[model samples]
Target chain A: MLLRLSWLLALLLAALPARGAELRLLPPGLAYCDELAARFSRLPGARQDAARGLAAEGGRLCEAGHARAGVARLRRALRAAQGAPRLARSAHP
Target chain B: MPHTRRRQQHPGPLWRLLSSAGFRFALLFAVVFLAAGLAFAGVLWWGTAGTLERQTDSAIRADAMALAERGRDSGLAVLAEAVEERLALDAEGLSIYLLLDPSGRRLAGNLAALPPPRSGDSSWYRLNVEHEDTGPGEARLLVLDLPDGSKLAVGREVSEKGRLRALLTEGLAWAAGAALFFALLGAWLMRRALERRLTPAATTAALIAGGDLSQRVPLSLHDDEFDRLGASMNAMLDRIAHLMDGVRGVSDAIAHDLRTPIARARNGLEEALLSEADDPATLRGAIERGIADLDNVTRVFQAVLRIAEVEAGARRAAFAPLDLSLLLADAAELYGASAEARGQTLNTLWPESLPLVGDRDLLLQVVANLLDNAVKFTAPHGTIVLSAWREADWVVVRVADEGPGLSAQDRTRVGERFFRADSARTTPGSGLGLSLVRAVVQLHGGALWFEDAGGPPGQPGLAVLFRLPVAA
Candidate 1:
C-alpha cells in the first residue's frame, strides 16, 4: 500500500504545469474576432481603450495575412496611432 | 550420493538406525530453505529490473524535450535540430524524434522520410536516422499525438544501464552468500541443539549396551519435552534392566542349586558300582539312580522349551474366536486326574458361553499350568477349582487352591524363572511353568493376577488368575 502511494506521488510530481503560450484559436475568415471586438468595447473605460487598439490592429493583421499591400499600409497607419495611446497608458500605469 | 545406482550404497540396519531422525530433519531443513531463498532472489531481480526500465525511459525523454526547445522552425526543421543536437551531446546516442504531417510526410529533423504512425505500441522500429558501427542494436520509439494534426515520435536505445547492471550483479552475489552463510549457521545450531537433547539418551543406551543395569537418564528442572522423553527412556531402561538382572540370577541359581541333586545321584551310582553288587537286585537300584539324574536334566530342558516357546510369539498365530467356558472345562478335566491321584478335590465353574478372541491353545495352556501348579503344591484333601466368567469386554479365568498359600513376598517373586517356595522346592517340576503362563497371558492382550486364597494365620497357596480380551 505504501509503494502505491509513492508511485502516485512520483507521477504527480512529473506532470509539471505547461509554461509557454499555446495557440489562441481563431475562426475561419474574419467573423469571430469582430464579434469579440464589439463585445470588448461595451466594457468599462480601461477596457474600451484596449478594445479600440485590438480592433485596429486586428484589421491590419488581416490585411497582412491576405497580402493586400495598399490596404495593409493604410490600416497600419490607423492602427499605429491607436496602438500608441494604449502604449502610453500602459507605460504611465 | 548421486541420483543413480543407489543400490551400491546399501548400508546395514546399524547405519539405518544412526541416520534416522537426525539425518531426516537436516535434509528437510536444507531443501525447504534453499527453495525459499531462490524464490526471494527471483523477486528481488524482478523488482530491480522494473525500476531500471522506468528510469531509463524518463531520462531519454528529458533529453529530447530539452533539444526540441532550440529548433527555430515548426515540424521538419525542429525534428532535424533535435536529432542533430542530441547526437552532438552524445555521439552514440540512438535517440530518434520525428514530427509528421497527417499525410505521413516528413516535416522535420534528421528523418529522411516518415513512416506511418503506429496503430498501437510496437516492437523495435526503424527511424530515418543514420549512424556508423557501434550503433544501437534496436531502438524504442513511440508515436505521440500532437495538437496540430501532427505527431511527436520519441525514444532512445541504450545497450543497458551499466551502473544498474553492476548493482544487480553485486546484489545477487550478496544474497546467495547470505543464504549459504545463514543456512550453514542454522544447520549447525540445529545439529548442536539436537545433540544436546540426545546426549542423555545416548549415554543411557551406551550403558545398557555395556551391560550396566544401574544407569538412568536424569530429568531437568525445565520439565521440557526433551526432559519428558529422557525420563520415559529411563523408566523403560529400568524395566528392561530389572528383567535382565532377574534372568541372569535365575539361570545362575538354577545351575548352582539344581546340580546338587544330579551330583548326589551320580555319587550314589559310583558308590553302588564300587560296592559288591553281584546280584541283579543291586544292579537295578543303580539303574534307578541314573534314571533320576536323566529325569532332572530332561525337566530342565523342558522348562527352557516352554519359556522360549511362549516368548517366540508362536501361539499368537493360532489366535481365533473361541468360548472361554470350553477352555475352563478342558483345564478342569485335564488336571482332574492329578488332583485325584493326590487325593485332592477339583471343581470347575464357567459361564454358559463366554466368547473371547485369543489363541485358544495358549489360553488353555495358561489355565492348565495354573491348575497343575495348584494340584502339585496342594496338600492331600485340599480344594482346587478352575473357573471362568466374562466381566465387561474381557473373559477372566481363575484357578484357586485351598493348600498352604504363598507368602506375600513369595507371591511377588513367583513368576521369576526357577523361583521356588522352600516347601515346593522338593516337588518334581521346573520353575519356568508359571513364568510361561504369565507370558502367554500377556501376549494375548490380557492381564494376570496372583492373589491369596483363604488360609488360617496367613494366606493359603496362591490363586492364579488371568484375563483375555473378548474382541482383541
Candidate 2:
C-alpha cells in the first residue's frame, strides 16, 4: 500500500506541472522554471541581483496566466542580464 | 680653316634646356596640373567642413527636441536638473550646455556665454563654454526658447575639428608645392633628352651652311624618324654632289674641245694669209673651212643647251598624247634614203598605234637622232631595224643596227655629254647625240639603255632601247 501511494504521489507531481498555466509561457517542450533560470544564469555577477528579482516576478506572472506582461518583463530581464549596449551613443550634453 | 673652325661656339647647357620643346610641354603640363589640384583641394575642404557643420547642427537639434519635450513634461527646475546631470557625465569636453531664465542669466549647465538668438530649425552660433578640467573652450552652439520663457543651449567644442582641418590644409599646401617641384625637374630632364636627340642634325646643318658641302647628318642603325630624315638628307646631298661633278666635267671638256676647233680655223686662216701669191679662190676656201669649224663648235653649244632645257622639265607643259608608232614610221622614212644611199636596209616593225604621253617635237627628235646614229654607223648593206610596241606599262621603241656595239666600259660613259665610243670617233657628228636622247627620255619619265643584238663575239650589233609611260 505504501509503494502504491508513493507511485501515485510521483504521478501527481509530473501531472501538476504539465497542467499549470505557465506551461504556455515556455517555448514548446521547455519547462517554465528552466527558461527563467537560463536567463538568470547569463546575468553578469554585478547585475544578477536586479535581473534575478525581475525574472522571479515575471515567472510568477506567467504562472498566473498573465503571459503578455510576463513576456515583456522577461525581455527586460534578458536585456539587463545580457548587458546589451545602448541603442545609440548619445552625446553627453 | 682652323681660325674659321674656332669661331663657332658651343651652346650653353642652360640655353639648350630652356630652348627644348619638351621643356615647354612639361611646364605647360605642370601649370595645368597645379590648377586642377588647387580646384580639387578647394572642393575637398568645402565638402569636409560643410559635412561636419551639418552633423553638428543635426545633433544639436535632436538634443534640443528631446530636452524641450522633457521640459514640457516636468517643470523648469526638473529640466535644469536634467541639464546638470548631462553636463556632470565623465565625457571629456565634447559636449556643451546652457540653461537660462527669462532674464538671460545662466541658471544651470556648462556654457559660460551664449550669442544672440537666430531663427531657423537649427542655427549655429559661437559660444564659450566652461569645463571642469579644461577651463573655458570655444564651441558651436544652437539655442531654443522654451514654453516657460527659458532658453536651452546645446553645443560641441570646435578645437578637434579645427585641428583636423588645419592639418588637412597644411597637407594640401605641401602636396601642391611638391607637384610644382617635380614638374620643373621633369621639364628640365625632358628638355635635355630632346636636345640630345636633335643636336647632331643641328650641327650638321650648321656645317653645311658654313660651306662644307661634304658634311652630312650622321646616321645610326636605329632607323628611327630622325635617322630616316638624316638618310634622306644624305641622299639629297649625294645627288647634288654628283650634279656638281657633272658640271665640272662639262666645263673642262668645253675648255679643251672648243679650243681645238678654234685653233684649227685660226691656223687655216693664217696659212691662207701667208701664201705669197694673190689667190682669191684659196682665200675663199679657207674662209669657208673656218666657217664650217665654227659651225661645228656652235652645234656643240646648241646641243648642250637643248639637253639642259629638256632635263630641266620645262617641256612637260607641252606634253600631249601622241602615237609613237607614227613617229617611228616617220623616222624610218626620213632616214630610209640615207640608209639606202649607204647600201643599208632600214626596216621598221611597229604596232598599228603605240600611244605615249610626251612632247611630240622632242620625241620626233629622239627618233630622228637614233635613226641618224644607226644610218651613220652601220656598214654598207647592214640591217637597221626600228621597232615600237607596248611592253607592260611602257611604250618601247628600239633601234637596232648591225654595227659595232658599245663595249661595257663605253656603254657606261655613252650617254654623257661630249662622250664618244672609240669605234665611232671617225664618224662626222658631235658626241652629244646620245646625251640629248637620254635627256629627252628622262624628261618623258622614260629609261634608255643599250643591249647587244645577236651576232658573233666582239661583233654584236648595237640595240638602243627606250621606254616611255603609256598614256592612260
Work out the TM-score per prediction: 0.60, 0.66
Candidate 1 lDDT, tens digit per residue, B1-472? 6587554454797676446676457555755675578667667765775566556566545544544443324554665544533322222233445566666676543333444444656522433223432232333444555545555565554335434656776887798788878876776677667778888888888987898868888777889988999888888987887878877887797887678778887887888888886888887888797788778877777777777787787767778889878777877887898899989999888879998788877777777788888987788988887777888888888888876677778878777788788878788677778888878887888877777776665536667888878887
Residue pairs of candidate 2 with colliding backbone atoms: none
Which CAPRI level is candidate 1? incorrect
TM-score, cand. 1: 0.60
Q: What lDDT would candidate 1 get against the real structure? A: 0.63
DockQ numbers for every candidate?
A: 0.02, 0.01
lDDT of each: 0.63, 0.74
Question: Which residue runs does candidate 2 get wrong by more than 4 Å?
Answer: A1-93, B1-178, B273-278
Judged by DockQ, which candidate is best? 1
Query: In model 1, what lDDT does residue B144 have?
Result: 55
